[model samples]
Target: MIVHIIKKEIHFRIIKKLCVCFQLLLIVSCQTDDDNPTLPVEDSINGFWFSEELGYILEFTEGNDVVYNINTAGCSIVDDDFELEDFVPSLVSANDLILTTDLNESDFEFTRLSNQNPTCLPDQIADTDDPKVNFDHFWNIFNDYYAFFETRNVDWSQYESLRDQVTTDNFYDILEELVLLLEDGHVSIFDEENGIQIDSGFPKLLETFNMNLSGDFIIENGDDLGDLFGQKATTIVTEYLGGDFEIDERDNILWGLINDTVGYVNVLTMAGYGSDFSNELSTLNDLLDTIMNDISASGVSKLIIDIRFNGGGHDTAALDIVSRFMDQERFLYTKKFRLGNTFTEKRAVSVGPKGDFQFTGDIVLLTSPASISAADLFALCMKDLPYVTIVGENTAGAFSNVLSHTLPNGAEIGLSNEVYEDPQGVIFEAVGIGPDNQENRVPFLSTLDFEEGIDSGINRALELFSN
Candidate 1:
């Protein structure tokens, strides 16, 4: 809604002075009317166009104008143009060239940019010579073809203008504005190539923060409920172990603490280490073995695993963890969605510790909205595990393993490529893993804002543990 212009100067050589002068004259010739604007008239647009993505300048010739020039393939001439009869009025106030053709008694709009500025002014007239005419023309075409016009409430003209000025750091703000225009949760901006990398679910990420286990367990340290849960779990594990437990700093894994009372394993992320970045199934198996040992020795009544900011990695680790809690070899949980009314089947089968490997004791887990990917895999897999309850908000639901590619014009599009389903075949595609016990923000702590009393999800899980 507000406009500001800052100028900077750069030095460059002047060449082909005659040709440049002649081109300027022709553009001036096409400026037939500044006043008494009525019927459409021929406009001239011939100049250099530059986009940061291409990292080069494009030259537009006066004759045989090319409407599109992909960075990799170079430029091409216009094959067809469409005219809009009543549509001309809508564009009259904006400074943009018009090119059109008639097809099936319908009108389409195009632009011829020669020497005009790419940014649109509220009431200013565009020059006849601008290369951005094609850009504007194609934008309008795509906007109509997709019919995704209600993406936002910002003025269309202003939106186009801001896009023309995409070099500024405020590009994120511009992208946010554009996202608001689409009004679709699936659509988001990804400008990694341009040094503006937006995450898969940035709209939500913008409002959330990721936290980890910080400092030693202390009741005096700022009423952090997360620390409280850890302290409680530690106390239970220590009592059963007889000897005190040790926090493994080498791996940040809390171990040597559960002496037959409960199994305590810390999962930093679903994604694993190394360049290949795969989950370490063997490591997970060893942790499960420790838990199984604890339960067997001390008749441990509960197991607690913490999951926070786990963006998911290997599927095998998920199976390993769930196998320790289940009694059967195969069980049902969920299904996944795919294109063409097709759904996939998912079965949770235990490959390790055959026969009576299931833990009858209560299963408790910690979570946050940031727990996504294969982390979702773990939560979803255990939704029905014996006595298993999750404490946290619904996950990011950014599943459906999607692939992303960029358009020739630098637009990025993401399409779902992989489908993830629960054992019974219920796919949680767009549906995130909702906690069995929901956690809302904590109040009076004034530190946390809750729609209900004290982090409902955490409190519910604590209540379950207390009972």
Candidate 2:
């Protein structure tokens, strides 16, 4: 592997390529069956509630509240600015607690810990250049918390031997090789102080997109494929939607009329809606409400919802947007976590109708490899509905809460520690949510397509609703 300082902008770009999945995760925990005996709501109100998905143990106490970021290496108190009311306490069972947060409508489910314990104390690992220490620590984290070794068909046990040969000189090389073996988009290693970051799956995905969709045309021009693709996607909206649209203040969502009866909504992300976390959900809802009213009033019988360019954000945001299309309550999806050999019970997730107007019209949801975590979740749930037709490529296939940990050498690492599935129990981890309509494949734009002013996805969607 190469040893170099990845640019600061490059690092942020990686973060952008990935999704802000943990905020949705920040709200969920290990959920078990309802048949388990229940505890009185008052008894389970306050204590250490473990969010297995987030790898955080939230200490909800009287007068004092705290959150701890945990991994096998140790525990660090997270300085999250969440308040008491942020977690409106409710009991699904004696051991199961839910926090109805104001950030999104999705409930934060937490499992009560029998005892308050962290993997170990922070600083327990010596802050030195000990390759073996860091190596072991890194491997152990995945051993204990990584949820998809079996699903990805990678042999974790096979990598154990690589530890003996790892050294100061070849540590990063070995690490890079290891990540490539895993092929998980959500798995990443970060050493900010050293400016070293290793992402397991994104490079391969981008390379594939360049080969398949863009035909390496952007690469031939010596421009960044991802960056150029985003610009073309934005331009495609203007090319197809007549260059007139309204966007939220942050530009996270864009909406306009493709035609009189066909309206379009392009969601770029599921998060970053407000200055304060307390009001984030409200800010998002207000924007969606505006979009909803416009669609309702226009009497659009066919709606094209484009999440092809989305970087994953909050689960609540995804569901909230999905809610605008639903006329009634419905089951959305399910998620769970892994504990060594065993797995947590499938926790069913559902969403209900929201806002003043719901567009229960013919819909086409466009997708791509850029559709990440929450974006993948959005596609998975939306495909379950009767009226929604997915008309693009598969999503990014990475749909778990990103769990992070620090090494003894102060290097940081993050990976998926949970599992997410469709409503019928199909795991979409290594494989993303694919389109339901297989025959008419509308992929993201190629450089050639952009040069010629063709927006195949929208054109194909328009054909679906033609009178």
Best model number under lDDT: 2
Using alpha carbons, what is the TM-score of model 2? 0.80
Location of the lowest summed lDDT over 10 successive residues in candidate 2: 1-10
- Tell me, by TM-score, which candidate is best: 2
Writing each residue's lDDT as its tens digit, candidate 2 over 72-133 gives 65554543344544334556777777654443333445688977764523444235668987
- The Cα local distance difference test for each model comes to 0.39, 0.68
Where is model 2 more than 4 Å wrong at Cα? 1-127, 213-216, 219-223
lDDT, candidate 1, equals: 0.39
The all-Cα superposition gives candidate 1 an RMSD in Å to the true structure of 20.5
